[model samples]
Target: MKGDYNFFSDKKDDPLDAVCPKLSYQQRLWGFLICSGIGWFLEFCAFISFFQGNGKEFAIIFSIGNLVAIMSTLFLSGPKDQCKKMADKSRLISTIIFFSTLIVTLVLAFATDLTFLTLLMTLVQFCAYVWYVLSFIPFGQRMLKKFFSSCCEFE
Candidate 1:
């Protein structure tokens, strides 16, 4: 099994090949979900302790949990193939939804008031997160793929 002959390998066999394998979409999605769950739990615990005046412990937990969440989210969103397939309209829509969600979440996180409107916005943010996840699902992926394919057919 010479390295030159192995197209599936990640790197060359100069005794320094990294063992990172390409994950399937399901694997990446599940990994992202699990890490997110763990990260959220750690953040919740940290927030609780922080509110209880345990500043040092809160900082430690908060930093570690956020590190995990950020890293996993960056790395475990599957391959970049789907990104290349996205149409301009789909990309624009996704970007708008993402930024809008971010704005709402930020406001909800820091706002002191707990009005009915705030609660309603929180619910909308939750639904937006669900939709954000759906945008990476196969249906969205296929839509992007088809967008490109149909354009190619016309051209």
Candidate 2:
């Protein structure tokens, strides 16, 4: 008789043993929301600090940095096997969009008076940066696990 070489089959029954469990829909949504909220809070703090005349350069750099941090967190939270691929694609695309918007917004802000359009553009930029962070960062994964473990009531 030949010996079995099915390493995966032996471990299949233990659901929790999987490297990444499939999250429920609610878990996924909640995790995304929490991560986005965190990103927004961080950006809001940066904005407030910058408003105190820390310098326009500081504000611009901090905005970019926040975007990068959020994306990094999202990339890290993905399944280990998919992390490299997802991070490379997501980070590259996000960086391009973030910087382009930043430059354009800065130009607009300087070229024109601080009117409604300027405020709108600034808000859009902040929201875009926050969105990238929440979507790409490992923040969603961490939040999901923490929430599911503590608050979920399984029947």
Candidate 3:
């Protein structure tokens, strides 16, 4: 008599399998570097402009803003086990920091001595901030996607 039997049907589901993919080390590193580098460059330009008598107060404020934004972005993007968990939050926080910096600059410009150099530096900083933010969205998305895909593949 032959007995019918089922084999290989006892596999337990893995909790890790259900988790969302995370960014790869290389991708995360690259993204962080790019964001931070741009932030530093913006700050550097602001500092130089301030030394040139281009609204020292405004330049300082804007430079601080850039630094805060960069730090926040890095913190939010740090080695997240789940990328989705922080993506939206990071974007929101960065946006807030960017706008706050703008508001601070405007207030300083009006409240303090608004010189020609100050006006140009402030305007340039604003333009640079906008460009940086806009560029980040796409760059971040691409980098994050690559990171996730690579992570999943690794798994």
Q: Which ranking of candidates, highest lDDT first?
A: 3, 1, 2
What Cα-based lDDT does every candidate model obtain?
Answer: 0.53, 0.52, 0.54
Candidate 2 per-residue lDDT, tens place, 15-125, comes to 332333444445545665676666566666756755775434334544555554444333223334334434476565655565566666666656755445555566667
Q: Give the per-residue lDDT digits (tens) of candidate 1, residues 1-155.
A: 45452133344433222222344567667877888888778878977986887544554565456545544563342223223323245555664664475465445445634434444554564455445555656596567668779889953
Over 31-94, each residue of candidate 3 has an lDDT whose tens digit, in order, gives: 6677677767767766676777767554665656575555545433342322333345646554
Q: Considering summed lDDT, which 10 consecutive residues are worst modelled in model 3? A: 1-10
Stretches of candidate 3 exceeding 4 Å from the true structure? 1-22, 56-61, 64-102, 110-155
Q: Given candidate 2, what's the lDDT at residue 120?
A: 59
TM-score of 3: 0.36
Candidate 3: which pairs clash? none
Which residue pairs in candidate 1 collide?
A: none
Task: Assess candidate 1 and give its lDDT.
Answer: 0.53
Highest-lDDT candidate: 3
